[model samples]
Each structure stands twice: as C-alpha cells, then as structure tokens.
Target: MLSALKRVLIGRPLKSTELGEQKLNKTKALAILSSDALSSVAYGPEQILLVLMTVGMAAFWYSIPIGIGVLLLLTALILSYRQIIYAYPQGGGAYVVSKENLGKYPGLIAGASLLVDYILTVAVSVSAGTDAITSAFPSLHAYTVPIAVVFVILLTLLNLRGVTESASVLAYPVYLFVLALFVLIGKGLYDMATGAIPQELHTPVGTPVAGIGLFLLLKAFASGSSALTGVEAISNAIPNFRKPAPVNASRTLAAMGILLAVLFSGIVLMAYEYGIAPIAEATVVSQIAEDAFGRNFMYYAIQGTTALILILAANTGYSAFPMLAVNLAKDKFIPRMFTARGDRLGYSNGIIMLGICSILLIVLFGGHTEQLIPLYAVGVFIPFTLSQSGMMRKWLREKPAGWGIKLAINTVGAAISFVVTMMFFLTKFPQVWPVLVFLPVLIWVLLGINRHYGAVGEQLGLSTGEPVEVIEGNVLILPVAGITHVVEQSLSYARSLAASQIIAVYVPFEREEEAAFRDKWSKLHPDVRLVTLHSPYRSIIQPLMKFIDVVDRKAKENHYQVTVIIPQFIPKKGWHNFLHNQTSFYIRTRLLYQKDVIVTTVPYHLKK
Candidate 1:
C-alpha cells in the first residue's frame, strides 16, 4: 500500500541502474539551477524600492545607483564562485572551500548560514509569489497561508519525482517570466527612445510614506542582495552537471549570472524610469507591467508567470539545501541518514525537509513577505564572504598558474562581501535575532551530532576491529500462559540453544488461579521448573520485569547471560491481533532494556 501510494504521488520508482540520472545540459541546467537568481528580478527591484521609499519619491532614483552597486558586487561574486567551482570539484562551494582553506568554525559558519538562508529564500519566495497571486486576483487574500502551503506540497511532490523531471516541469514558467520581463524592458526602452515617455504609476498606491538617507540605501542594498543568494547554487551542485562537470558547471554559472544581470538590471532600470513605487496591493513589478502594458491579457499573462516563478523559485532551496545537508552529514555534523539517496536519486530527505521547513515558514509568517523580508539576506551574505575569503586563502597557499590574478579577484570579492554581510546584519538586527541565535545553536548541534556518532562508533568498537566478548553460560526464561503448544515449542527451542538452565514463569492474579495453573502445568513438567509469580494489583509486565531483573542480576554474578524467550501466535487475519492483549510484547519490551538480558520472540502462525 505504501509503495503504491508513493508511486501514485511521485510516479513509479526508477531502477538502481536508472538511478544514474540523465546529466543536465546547460539550458536545462540554467532553468533548474538558476530559477532563484532569475526569479529574484521579480522582487529584487522592489526590495530595493521598499528601502528607498522611506525617503519619499526624491530618493527613488537612488535605486539606479544602489542597483548598479549590487550588480558590480554580483560580478565579483560570479567571478569568485566560478573559481570555487573549479577548485572544489567535489562540490562544497562555500562550505568546502572555507572548511578547507579557512579554519573549522569558519566552514561551519558558512554551512549554518547557508542552511538558514535557504529556508529564508523559500519563505520569501513563496510569500512573494502569493503576493503576485493576490495582485492578479484579490479575492484569494484570505487563503494566503493555505495557498502557499499547497504550493510547497505541490513542488515537493514534483521534486521527489526527480531532478530532471522537476527541472523540466519548472522550466516553462521560468522562461515565461523572463520573456515577460524582457518584453516589459524592451517596450519601456522603446517608449523612451520613441519619446513616448511612460508615466508614473499612481493607481492603488499603498502607504504614502517616504524618507531617504544613507541608512535607507544600505537597507535597500541588503534587501536587493537576495538576487545574489542563488549564485552559489550551481557551484555547489557541480557534480549534477554532465561530463566535464567543472566546465559544464562553470558555463552554467556564467549563464545564470548573465541572465540574472540582464533581467535584474533591466527591470530595476525600467521601474526607475517608470517611477514605480512600493504599493500595498500590487508589487513594483506588477505596477511596472501595468504601466508598460496596461491592464490587458499580456499584463495578466506577465503577472501569472511572475506568480509561478516566484513560488517555484523556492526550488532553489529545495535543489541545493539537501545536498548541503548531506555533505554536513558526511562530515559527521548531522545524521548519516541524510546522506542516503531517495528512490528518485535526489536528496530525498533533504528535499522533503526543505519542503517541510518552507511550509512552516509560510504558515509562521502568515504568508507576509515583508515580515520575513528583513531576515532573508543575513543568511546569504555571510557565506558569500566566507567563501571568497577561503578562495583567496586557497590561491595564496597553492600558487597555481594564474593564482596571482585569482587572488586579487577573490580579495576584492571578499572585501565587498564582508561589508555587505555586516550591513545586512546591522540593518536587520532585532528582526534577525532569531537567525543570529539559530546559527550558534546549529553549530552546537553539529558538534553534538559528531560526538554522538563518535561515541557510538567507540561503543561498537568500530575503530579497534576487536571481537565482541560473549557471555560464557546461557540461562533461558520463558513466560507462559500455562503449558500449550506455543510454550512447549518455546521451551524445546530454549533447551536446544545450549541452555544450562530453563525456567518457565507463570503469573497468577489469585491463589485459586495459581493452583489451577500448577495443576495444568504439571502435565508438561517433565524437564524445566515452573515458577509462579503472584500479582496482587494485576500488573503483568511490572511483576514479570522484576523476575527478569532478578534473573539478570544472578546471571551477572555468575558471569553468564539470561535470555527471555517470548513465544507468540500470529493470527491468520490481521483483525485477530486486536482480540489479543499483546502481553508478550509488553514483557519483551520491558526485558530488552535490562542489562545481561537477551530477548527472543518465537512466532507460531495460527492455522485457523
């Protein structure tokens, strides 16, 4: 039933032979890997405007300057991450680069920050997408959380289908969004060139507040940095590309950066030229589209695509976060189960976990993109800084061919990223306190996981290659319901296991019941002794556990082991199980926890 359900939800499972998933070519790779960066053009400009709006309309033009700064930073980041792809082909991106070139905690800091940022990315993206939906159709405003959660679920199922499958499914919506933005930019450009001058958008103007200062511009720059969050994804997932993985990954990273540059700068420029502002009811992108295309089918089409790509942009987190988690697990920083592949050859645990987290964030913030907006960039920029710094270190230490040029680029990138990271932290401080608190706790968790795995390895003696010592003698204890075929078989099997002693225990609630049990037990009292335990309160497991405890203590004193053999009858039909009280399970569960006690369940299938 479970297998059938899984097949129904995610399609049939592929064979192990088929698990070597088809390698992603550049185009599909961009669509699959670049959705987050590409889709951010939808909201990245608005995030900038949201900051600048604090200073009023006069300060809005600063978006052009802030955006130019962001693009230059993006260029440095792209250059540094491209080097990261080649240097670390095993695909740790920032975490590996930093862990290897920088110190231990630095790498951990990168990992934890990226982990948090990816979750924030999902929350921000889904909420923004839902905003787009409400923009197009305002009636669904009440169902924001539910709608966002449903989208998370839908994306999860699609991702579980497989990467190539999810990528294919997501590609069209992304393409549509990019095309819409280009058309918006092209038409806006034509208007400027032809002297048709697009007018400022005033309809549905939300909250007429405005202010401007250095602080506000700093905030805008930090917020707009979400566009750069997914830039490292392709670098981290280099192995997911076809042969010549590094080269393919490098080209894909370049392509993603170029697309992000065009779409992001184009949209921001258009908004600035068109005088679009942050509105309560509609987004800056939506407002720009309305001004450029008017309220027509094309306007609605662009809005639809925006909503889609926004929601699916969470795919960036889904695609990369799990792989990061698996790497952490490999380093013994997390549970090893994360390192296992899903039936679809994706990081199944990672994908599902990302979905669950995104759903939680969606519900927690009530699908308000703005409420969670302040915390978004804090997670991304720290890793950016750490990675570039690590790259600089990698070059200085190795001094490979062209290392001189690479080192200079990395130093510049690192310096810029470091400043952006600090700005993000200060700008989003109290709003981001939870994330700041979460990072240290996450590192502590990684350490704790490492300790536990190490302790388990030691206890299991996996490090020493020594054989486990076995107890010298064997004593068997069987709890019986009088003497039946089940008990008879259990005792016979117990005797066959080289049992030095075998005792059959019968618990009775009353003296009369004990006498009757003894009378019936006398018929099979040929070999083992029958010990009767009386329970005044009618607690079966409690009394049976005490007897096992006494036996285990005695066995330890004698340098031996006590085996508790539980004989149970399996019902022919499943419902028959409900008719039984499951006393054997209770006694076995209690006894298994006692030291020096061995537990064995012998099943007898009922014929009728």
Candidate 2:
C-alpha cells in the first residue's frame, strides 16, 4: 500500500539512464534556479523602505539611492558568479571554489554558510509569500504559519517528484509574475509620464528612531541586500543545466541578474513616484497596483501572482540545497547518505531534510518575513565574500587568460560583499547574534566530521605487504529457547559448517523445564553437547553473553573461530510478530559488539 501511494505521489522509479533527460534547458533552468532571485523584487524594496520608515516619512526619500547601491552590488555579484561558473564547471559553488583555492577550513566555512542560507531561503521566501496572501485578504492573517508550512511541504513533494518535472511545474508562475509586474510598472510609468497627480498613500508617519546619517543609510542598504540572497544558486547548480552546462548556466545567471535589476528598480521607482508607503496589510507592490489600476482585476492579479512566485521562490533553495549537500558529502564533511539520489534522480534525503528544517523555522518565527530577513543575508554574503576571495586568489595564482581583469572584478565583489556582511552584523546583530555564533560552531562541527572520516580511513586501510589470514576450523554456539523445529533447523545448519565442536545452550527459568528439555534431548541421542544455564532474575541475555565470552576465550586457545547461531521464526504477517517474545533478536544484538565472535540468524518461515 505504501509503495502504491509513493508511486502515485512522486511517480514510478526512474531508470538511471534517464538522468541525462532530467537535465534542464535554459528556459526551464531559469524558472527553477532563478526564481528566488527574481521573486525578491516583490519584497526587496519594501525591506529597504521598512528600515528607513523608522526615521519617519522624510527618510523615504533615500530609497532610490539605496536601491541603486543594491543594484551596483548585484552587478558585482553577477560578474563574479559568471566567472565562477566558467572557472569551476564541476560546480561545488563557493564550497568547492574556496576549498580548492584557499584551504579546507575556508571551504568548510563557505559550505556551512551556504547550508544555513539555503534553509533560511525557504523559511524567508515562504514567510514572505504568506505575507503576500495576508496582504490580499487580511482575514487569513491568523493562518499564516500553517499556510507557509503547507506550501513548504507541497514544494518538497513536487521537488521529490524530479528536477525536470518540478522545473516544468514552477516555470509558468514565475513568468506570470514577471509579466504582471512589468504591466504594473509600465502602467505606473505611463501615469508618471502623463503628469498624473500622486495618490495620497495615507502612510502612518512613525516617530523618528534614528537621524539621517551614514549608519541609517547603510542599515537600509543592508536590509535591501535581500535582493542578492539567491544569486549564488546558479553558480552552485551549473551541473543541472543541459549540455554546455557552464555556458548555459552563465547565461541564465546573467538573465536572472538583469531581470532582478529592472524589476527591483521599477518597483522602487513606482513606490516613490506614487507616494506608496507599505501598509500593515497590503504590500508595496499591491499598494502601487491599487493606486495605478484602482481595486480592479489588475490589482488582485498582481497580488495572486506575487504570492505565488514568492512561495515558488522557495524552489530555489530546494534545488540548490540538495546539490550543495551532495558536494559536501562527497568530500566527507557530511554524511555520505546525501550523495545518493532517489528513484526520481533527485537527492531525496537532502530535499526532505530541507523541508523539515524550513517548517521548523516557519513555526519558530511565526511566519513573520521581517523577523527572518536579518538571519537571511548574513549566510548569503559570507559565502559570497568567500567565493569571490577564492576566485581572486585563484586568478593571482593561476593567471589564466584575462586574469588581471578577472582578479579586479573578484576583488571588488569580495570587498563589497565583506562590507555588506559586516553591515548586516553591525546593524542586525542584536536580533541575529545566533547566526554569527552558529557559523563558527557549524564550521567546527564540519572539521570534526572531516577528522572522524580521516581516522576511519586510516584504521580500515590495508597495508600493501600485509599477509591474509586463513581459518581451518570453528566452534559453533547455538542459543535455543526450547525444543522446536526452529532449534532443529539451527542445529542442522550449524552441523553443515563442519566446526570443531557444536554446543546448544539454553537458559531455563525453572528447574522442571530444564529436566523435560534434558529428557527430550537424551531421547534424540544428540551428536552435539548441550549446556544449560540458570537465570534467577529471568535475564536471558546476561548468562548467554557470559558463557559466550568464556567459549570465545577457549576457542582462542585452540586456534578456532567462534560462530553463534540464533534460532528464530518468522510470523506469517508482519503485525503477528509482535505476539512473540524477541529474545533471539536481543541475543543477536548483544553479540554484535563482541570482536571475535561471529553471529548468524537461522529463520523458520511459517505458512498461514
């Protein structure tokens, strides 16, 4: 039943050979990979306005300058990541680039930062999308947390279905969002051109919390840095593109950056010219739409598509997190299970883990977008700084064609990213100190994992000139609960091993039961010896383990191997097995820690 249900939800198991077909083309790739970066235009401008709003309505005049600064930063990241796409076509993104060019510790830091950022991507994107929903219908505000979590689950399931399939599924809404926003922006621009009067937004002017100073402007810029959150995703997932992966991925990255700039600039411009201030319930974009189109179909269309693309924007993290995990796992810095693909050729474990973490974050933050935004940019920018720094170091060392220009671009990108990261820490640290603390702790954990894997390899590694061991004979110890066909089958199998000796051991709870077992054993004229043990406390495993230890020591003296056979029976149905005691299982589990003792299970299948 479970298998049938899984088949229905995620579809049937795909063949390994179909992996090539799963790779995406440029258009679908743009939809799946670039959605997060593109969707930020919906909320990115508002984040800047939100920060500046603390200083009263007069501070709203600074939105354009901050927006331009964000665009310049965005341009730097685009150029740097395009270089990253070509330089490291194998595509580990920041983790690989930093590790290979810098050192292991730097690489681990980059990996840890990207991992945290991806989780926040889902949480922040979904929360922002839920805010969009509440913005449309204030009555649904109470259900925001539940709505966001449900969307995360649905996105996770869609991704589990397969990459190509999920991309195909998410592409339409992204394009729709872009088209809708363009119409709104164009209409707003036409009104401005035709000398239409500005609508009174009736924005509540809050008391000024901070003066208009350098710190205030930088704080607002740091807030707007959410626009650059998902930029690294394309660089990380270059391998997911079709043939000529690097070229296609670079083009997609460029296209994504261009769209982001235009949309972001247009929205901010519209907000300023229309005197649109963000209200508690409606978003800046929605407000702009209402002013330009006035409570009509266009207004709700922008809200519907905005809610959709923001939610679907979480798909960016869904695509990149699993890919990044696979890279980390390949390097032994994380568990190897992440490297395995699911039946649909997606990294199912990583995808599901991302979903679980995102849902937890949504619940913890109460689906508040602003509360989660502070934690978002630090993770992204730290990696951005590391990646560009790594690239700069690479160009200086390798000095490939056009190395000087590449170095300069990366140097600027790295400097800008570092400054923004510090700005994020300085401006948002009171609320975001946990992330600052988490980055170091996470890097330490990654180092510990790397050390452990190294130790394991050292211990398990075989020396070149080592001689192989040959075993001549073995001692078979069979543990039996009572005289039954299960015991008979165990003894027969043990005899076939041609051991030096076979001992059938039993732990009897009562003297009467031991006597009856001995009488039956004597009637059979058994070839193997029978050892009986007493358990005053009815602890079966304790006496059995003690006896096995003694027998194993004796076998060592005789140069014989020790093998313990556990006799068990399978119930006809899985649920029926609960009716029987699991003593055989306990004995087998206890024997697992014994270094020189071999354990085996002999099963008697029952037909019902």
Candidate 3:
C-alpha cells in the first residue's frame, strides 16, 4: 500500500539505464538550475532599499549605485563559474576546486558553506514566494510559514521524481516570469522616457538615521548581495546537463546572469523613479507593478509569476546539494547513504535532508525573508571567495594557455568576494555571527567524520598473509521465555547446525515462573539441557548477557564457536509489534557486538 502511494506521488520507478535520458537540455536546464538567480530579483532590490531606507528618502538615491555594484559582482561570478564549469566538468563546484588546488580544509569549508547556503536558499526562496502571495492577498499573511513549508514539501516530492520531470514541470513558469519582468521593465522605461507618468520629486522629509558614508553604502551593498546567492549552482551541477555539459551549463549561467541584471537593476531604477518605498505588507516589486499597471491583471500577473519563480527557485538547491553531498560522501567526509540513488535516480536521502532542514529554518524564522537574508549572504560569499581563489591557484600552478587572463579574472572575483564577505561580517555582525560560529563547527564535524571513516577502515581491514581459520565445534544457546511454536522453530534450526551442545537459557522474574518453565521442559522431553537464571530486578537482557559471557569463555577455551539463536515473532500488522515484549530483539542487539559470537533470528509469522 505504501509503495502504491509512493508511485502515485512521485511517479513510477525509473530504470538506471534511463539516467542519460534524464539529463536536461539548455532551456529546461535554465529553468531548473537558474531559477534561484532569476527569482532573486523579487527581493534583492527590496533588501537593498530596506537598508538604505534607514536614512530617509534621500538615502534612496544610492539604490541604483548599489544595484550596479551587485551587477558587477554578478558579472565576475558568471565569468569565474564558466571557468569552473570547463575546468571541473564533473561538477563538485567550489568544494572540488578548493580541495584540488587549495587543500582539504578549504574544500571542506567550501562544502559546508555551500551546504548551509543551499538550505537557506530553499527557506529564503520559499519564504519570499509566500511573502508575494500574502502581499497579493493580505488574508493569507497569517499562514506564511505554513504556506512556505507546504511549498518545500511539494518541491521535494517533485524533485524526487527525477530531474527531467521537474524541469518539465517548472520551465513554463520560469519563462513566463522572465517575460513578465521584461515587459514591466520595458514599459516602465518607456514611460520614464516619454513622461507618460508624472515623476514624483523627492526631498529629504525625515531626519536621516545616520550620515551617508562609506559604511552605509557598504551595508547596502552587502544587503543587496543576496541577489547573487545561487550563481554557483550551475557550476555545481554541470553533470545535470546534456552532452557538452559544460558548454550548456555555461550558456545557461550567462543567460541567467543577463536576466538577473536586467530585472534587478530595472526594479531598483523603477523604484527610485516612481517613489516606491518599503512597505510592511507589500513587496517592492508588487508596488512597482502597481505603479506601472495599477493593480490590474498585469499587476497580478507580475505578482503571480514572481511568487511561482520564487518558489521554484528552491529547485536549484534541490539539484545542487545532493550532487555536492555525493562528492562529500565519496570522499568519506559524510555518511555513505548520500551516495545511493533512489528508484527515480535522484539522491533521495540528500533531497529529504535538504527539505527537512529548510522546513526547520522556515518554522524557526517564521518565514520571514529579511531575517534569513544575513545568513544567506554570509554562507554564499564564503564559498564564492574560496572557489575563485582555488581557480586562481589552479591557473598559477598549471599555467595553461591564456592562464594569465583567467588568473586575473578569478583573482578579481576572489578579491571582490572576500571584501563582500568581510563587509557582511562587519555590518551585519549581530545577525550573521551565528554563521561565523556555524562554519567552524561544521568544519570540525566534517573532519571528525573523515577520521571515523579512516579508523573504521584500518580496524576492519585484513593484514597481508593472514590465514582464515574455521572452528569445527559449535555451541548453540537459545534464550527462551516458554515453550511454544516459536521456540520449537528456533530449536529446530539450532539442531540443524549439528552443534556440540544446545542449552536453553531462561530468565524468570518470579520463582514460580521458573518452576513452571522447568516442568514444561520436562513435559516436552527436550534433548537440550535447561539453564535457569534468576533476575530479581526482572531485567531480561542483563541476566541473559551474564550467562552468555560464561558460555563464551568456556567455548573459546574448548575451541568451539558460540551461536545465540533468538526466536522473534512477526506480527501480522506492524502496529501489533508494540503489544509484545520484544525480548528477542534485546538479546540480538546486545549480542551483536560480542567478538567471535554469532547471533541469528528465527522468525514465526503471526496470522492475527
């Protein structure tokens, strides 16, 4: 029944041989991979204006400049990531580049930062989408967190279906969003050029919060940097593209950067010309749309597309995080479960983990996009700097054809990204300090995981010239509560082993219970001897463990192997298992760690 439900939700299982068919073409790839960058226009301009608003209307003058600065950074990222795509077409992105060129610690840092940023990408994108919905229909404001969480779950299930499937589902909305924004920008610019709409002249009306200075401009620049959060995703997931993966991915990335620059700068410029201010209920884009189209169908069309692309933006994280995790897992820096693909050929574990973590952030932050922006930028720029620096090192070390130009591009990207990262730290220290603390702790945890994998490999590995020996004699012990069909089945399997001796060990809470069990054993005329252990505290596992210890010592001394056979009853219904004592479960669990002792379970299925 569960399998049927799963099939219905995520579609039928996809064969492994169909993996190549799941690869995306450029148009679908653009929608699936670039949505996060494209959708940032919804809130990126607003975040910039949010900071500049502190200084009153006059401070709004800096919005266009800040937007330009963010665009320059976007250009650098696009060029740098194109280099990354061609260089590491196998696609681990910053983590792979940093590890190969810089070192292990830097790679892990890049990995951890990207992981955090991807999670925040889902949370912030979904939250921003929900914000658009609530802005359009004020009544839904109270359910923002719930709505955002629902979108996360929906996207999770969609991606779990497979890459091509999700691209097919999301491609239309992404293109529609781009068209709507282009129309908005084109019409707004036309109006401004022809004086069709009256321009509101602004003078400083309220007291400036602080004197406009380098610090204020830097803060605004740092805040606006959220627009560049998902720029690296294309490089991270190059393998998701079709033939000539790097070229297709690079083209998609360039297209995304162009669209983002046009939309983000258009919105910022339009906000300034139309006297749009940050409102608690309405979004900056929504207000710009209203000013352009006056709450008509076009206004709602912009809001609708904005909401959709924003929600679908989370798909970028879904695509990137799992692939990055696969690399990390292959390196033994994380659990191996992430390396496994599900029936649909998606990284199910990684997708589910991303969903769960994003939902947590959404709930904790109450789905507020502004609150998550600081965390978003801090995580993003760290990897951005690391990736570019790693590329710079690569160019310097290899010195391939045209290495100097590539080196200069990556160096400029690295320097600018490093400065932006520092600015985020300095200006938003109160909000971003947690990310600073988290990055180091995450690095420590990743190192610990690597050490544990190393230790496990060393301990479990065989040495050269080691001989494999087998014991001829077998000593079997069964822990039985009472004689029943379950016990009989266990005894039958034990007898088939042809052991040297078979002992039935029983632990009884009361003296009368032991006496009754002894009588039952005699009535059965059992071939095996019965050993009774008293447990005054009624602890089943403790008394049984002591007896097993004694048996183990004697067996080893006599060169015999000890095998503990446990009789476990299988209930007809899963929930019915809760009604039983589960004594056999405890025995098997405790004996699993015992050296040179074998444990097995004989199951008796229940009809009712």
Candidate 4:
C-alpha cells in the first residue's frame, strides 16, 4: 500500500542506469544551506513580543535587551557552529557533535530536538505569514488555517520535484525580503532621529506594571531569544554545500548573522519609535508600516513583503526536516521510513510527514502566532545548549594553541544558553510542559523500536557475533501458473539459478488444467523437474505450502537450501489488480517463514 501511494505521490523511480548525474555547484549549494537562516527574519520579532505582552506595556521595553541578547547569542552560536562545520563537514550537525563528544543518548536528544524544531519552523513560519496576509486582507483571517495548509502542500510538492527547483524559486523572495526590510529600517530610523515622525503615530497596547520583577525580565528575555530559532540550520546543512564545504558554510553563516542582526535590531528600534503596541496578536512589521507610511501604497508593499518573507521562512523547515530525519535514521533514533529517498533523490516521505504535522499545529493553535509562541523556544534552545557543550568538548579534544580562545567563547555561550533554556522552561512550563513530557516519551518509544529491530536481527542470524566471514549459497524455485510467457520467464529464471538445482513447481487446482500443464512442461523442458501438487479444496496457498515443506525436508537431507523465485506480472494500470489473482504475493510471504529459504522476484512487464 505504501509502495502504491509513494508511486502516486512521487512518480516512478529512475534507475541509476537511466540517467547522467552532476554535482551541485557553489551557487546551488549556497541557496540550499542558507534557506533556514534566511527564514528567521519573519517570526523573530513576533516571538519576542508574544511573551512581553503577558506583563503589559512596561515589559515591552525589555524587548531591546532581549533583542540585544539574541543578537549576541546568534553571533556566539554562529562562531561555535563554524567550528562544527570545520570539524564535521560531512553534515551531522548537532547530532554528530553530541554523539562524538557526549554519548548516544545525548545524540538522540539532539536529534529529536532538531526534528521537532524543524517541524515547528514550518508551522510557525507559515502561520505567521498567514497572519501577515490577514493583516492586509482581513477576509483571509477566516481562512487562515486552510491557506497555511495549502502553502504546506504546495511547498511539499515543489520539494518533491527537486531541491534545486524549490531553492531556485525560494531564493528570490528571501533576497527581496532582506532588501525591503533594510530599506524600511533605514528610512524609519532617518525619520525618527530628525524629529519628522508623525505626532499621532503612537498606539500603546497596555499600561505598564509598576512592580515588575526579575521573573518578568527573564520571561521577556526567553521570549526574545525565540529570534535565534534558525541559527543551527546552517550547521546541519554543511554537507549540502559545494566542495570546500566549511569555507562556503562559514561565509554563508557570516552573511546570515549580519543580515539577521541588522533586520532584527531595525524592527525593534522602529517599533519603539512608532510606540507600537506590544499586543500578543500583533506583528511589529505591520505596525511599523502603519506608523511610517499611514495606510499608503508603501504600507501595502511592506505588508506584502512581510508575508512573502514569512512564507519563505517556512521553506527553512522544508530543507531541514528531511536532513534531520536522515540523520536520526542513521543513528537508529527514528523509523527507517524517514530515511527512504524518493524518485527525485529527496526524502519524500519525511517531507510529507512534516507537512502533515505542521498543518496539525496550525489547526491546534487556530493559526494564532501568539498562542504558538510559548511552545516554540523550548525545543530550539535545548538543542542549542547541547550543541555548544559538544563544541566545548570538541575544542578540548583538538587542544591547539589557539584552542583556549575558542573554548572560552564556547564555554560562555554554553553557560548563557543553558541558563536561558532553563529560564524558558521555568517561565513557560505552564504552557510548554506538555511538550517537554511528550518529547521524552517519544524518544523512549523510538529507542524501544530500535531495540526491537536489534532483537529481530539477532534471531535472524543476520548479526555477526565477532564479524567473521561466512559463505552463503543461492537457489531459485519459480512458481508457475501455466504454460505462458510468464511461466516461460519463470523457467528462464530457474535456469539462471542452476548453480543450485532449478525447480519449476505448479499447483493444480483443477484436473484438466493439471494434465494440460504436465503435457506442456514435458514438451518444453523434458530434462527439468516439473513437480505437480494437487489442491483437494482448490486452495492455492495450502497446496504450495505442503509442496514447499516436502521440498524443505529433501533439501535438509541433501544439505542444500531453497530459494523461491516468484514470477510476478507488473500491472500497467491500477485496476488490473482486480482482474488477476494475488497467489504470487501469498506464496512469497509463506516462503519467507521457512528457514534457509530465500526469495527472489523476477517481474514480467505486461504489454502496453
């Protein structure tokens, strides 16, 4: 069923023999790696205000410090991750760092956190984009969830087509967003400083609390740190870059950091100058436009740009989810389904899964940016703390003369991030505790699944006790229905397995057909053994099983194993399945249960 669905969704697989291949050049590589970092410009500000709104207007002032802290964190994270790119350019990201330094459990923790973060990146970004669009056209407010779901579907389809194709389309909107944001910030700052700001521009959301304390301040900082969500994405994508990966990745990281700091700081300053309300439901970009341009064409342009950038931000998840899923699969922390590559050389199953999960989140939060904010930063910062700690271990291991400098930087980064993670967990536990509980249970389940697979492997004798070499033999047994082209192909396959004696077995359901098959086989291949088994109740599988048991007994005596080569007819159309019997499928499955019995399928193509 999964095979049929995969074919329908992603198209038929291309054989390696059928196509030429080329490697990704620097431009293509840069676009792929930069997707997540470029996406952050969308929701970073909204996340900051989301928490501040809880304590009213005075708490909004904390956004300045929060934004500054996030910028510094971003820089520290960028520098630390630069070391990761240099050390493990093959692109394991946080998972690799933790595994190499910490233990497998830490690696699993990192992997799970990364996976959740990627999915949220998709949900939050799309929901935020929908919010931006609704701000411009209030009618969209009613259809926000549906619209966001449609975007997820569209993005999934584009990714299934190919990474290069999706990246090409996304690169332009991201660049446009950066340019428009810089221009708007520059203009807003110039206007504010010259005393040319409008008199009626200010609109405060709530009154300040006179006795706000440290708890409120920490809460605000945690909210602002949400801006750092996409910082780790580049580290995860180092393997996707061109040759000399670390060099290219470092440059990309630098570019992302500079742009993010400028855009994020600019938005905060502009919001403050315009006296934009710290409403939980409001986006700073929209407020800045309303204050600076006053419902004019420029305001409309900014709204459109903001929406575009938010949608593009979701594209970050499109690139990260599949890669993270692949890493987890490698480490046996996720189901192998995530590791399966589609026809387009992308993780199609993982992409579809991410889209579905994102859609659920959008529905759960009712597409409200404010409601989803509390649940956002907890997963991201946990992984950030672990990654920095891993980097500290990495620097200690290398022990170069200049290592002390890097280690000091990473140590401070780790301590700050760790404290921030704890602060967010404490402040937001009422809302986010459910996720913390849910994630550990999910991780434990995954570990149990991997253990089960290991047990099965042991039972199957597929696991090596001491990794010794052993020789194995192959045998082929083709199940023939009648004397036709399919039967002929089966005979040919049996001949190919002549190294082990080839046998063609036929199950007789009716007397007349049984006689006919015997007569035809005698004429076709007189020397080859043609065994016939009678099905008293006209049951195909029962007769086949009895015959295989008898054959198994003979093979045991002779010390030779059996290989069942089933001749399957490939259906050209879906409805053809109803026209033919499913005997081959049942036969293959039954044969699999017999010890020392191997199965091979020789498929026959139906005529066009």
List, residue by residue over 1-608, the lDDT tens digit for candidate 4.
88898677655676544322312444554455554555555556656666666665555666677788878887888888888888888777888888788888888888888788888888888888888899888866789899998988888877786666677777777777777788788889889789888745443434455656777777667777777788888778665565676788778777777877888888877776676774534467887877777888888887887787787677777777787888878767677888886787777788889888988888888887766656767788888888889889888887977899889888978987898888877877787886768789878987997897777767778445655433244445667877777778877767765556667788887888889989988998897778888787888788777777788767767666777888888888878988988988888888778776778888888876
Over the stretch 58-108, how does candidate 1's per-residue lDDT look in tens digits? 576777778888899999989999998888888878888889988889999
lDDT of 3 by residue, 1-608 (tens): 89999999988998899999999999999998999999998888888888888887778868877888999989999999999999999999999999999999999999999999999999999999999999999999999988999999999999999999999999999999999999999989998899876745443333354578888888889888888889999999998899999889989989988888888898888888787889998998999899899999999999999999999999999999999999999999999999999989999999999999999999999998988989998898999999999999999999999999999899989998998899899988888999878889998999999999998887778954456656869899998888889999999999898889999998999999999999989779467899999899989988888888999999888888999999988999998989887778877888998888999899999998
Candidate 2 clash pair list: none
Q: Which candidate would rank higher by lDDT, 1 or 3?
A: 3
Pick by lDDT: 2 or 3, better one? 3
Compose the digit string of candidate 2's lDDT tens values, residues 1-608: 88999999899999999999999999999998999999988888998988878877667768888999999999999999999998889888999999999998899889999999999999999999999889889999999999999999999999999999999999999999999999999998898789784445423233243488888888889888888889999989988999899999999999999999999999988888777676788888889988899988999999999999999999999999999999999999888899999999999999999999999999998998888888888888889999999999999999999999999999999998898889888988887899868889988888788889998887777954556555668999998887789899998899888888999898899999888988888787467798989888898999999999999988887778899999899998999988988888888888999988999999999998
Candidate number achieving the greatest lDDT relative to the actual structure: 3
Q: What is the TM-score of each candidate against the true structure?
A: 0.93, 0.95, 0.97, 0.79
Pick the winner on TM-score between candidates 1 and 4.
1
* lDDT of model 3 at position 258: 89
The C-alpha lDDT values of all candidates are: 0.84, 0.90, 0.91, 0.75
Candidate 4 Cα misplacement greater than 4 A, ranges: 1-41, 160-165, 196-208, 278-282, 322-372, 441-539, 563-574, 600-608
TM-score of 4: 0.79
Q: How many backbone clashes does candidate 1 have?
A: 6
Residue 82: error of model 1 in Å? Answer: 0.2
Q: Per model, how many backbone clashes are there? A: 6, 0, 0, 0
Q: Between candidates 2 and 4, which one is better according to lDDT?
A: 2
Ranking by TM-score: 3, 2, 1, 4
Taking all chains together, the TM-score of candidate 3 against the true structure is 0.97
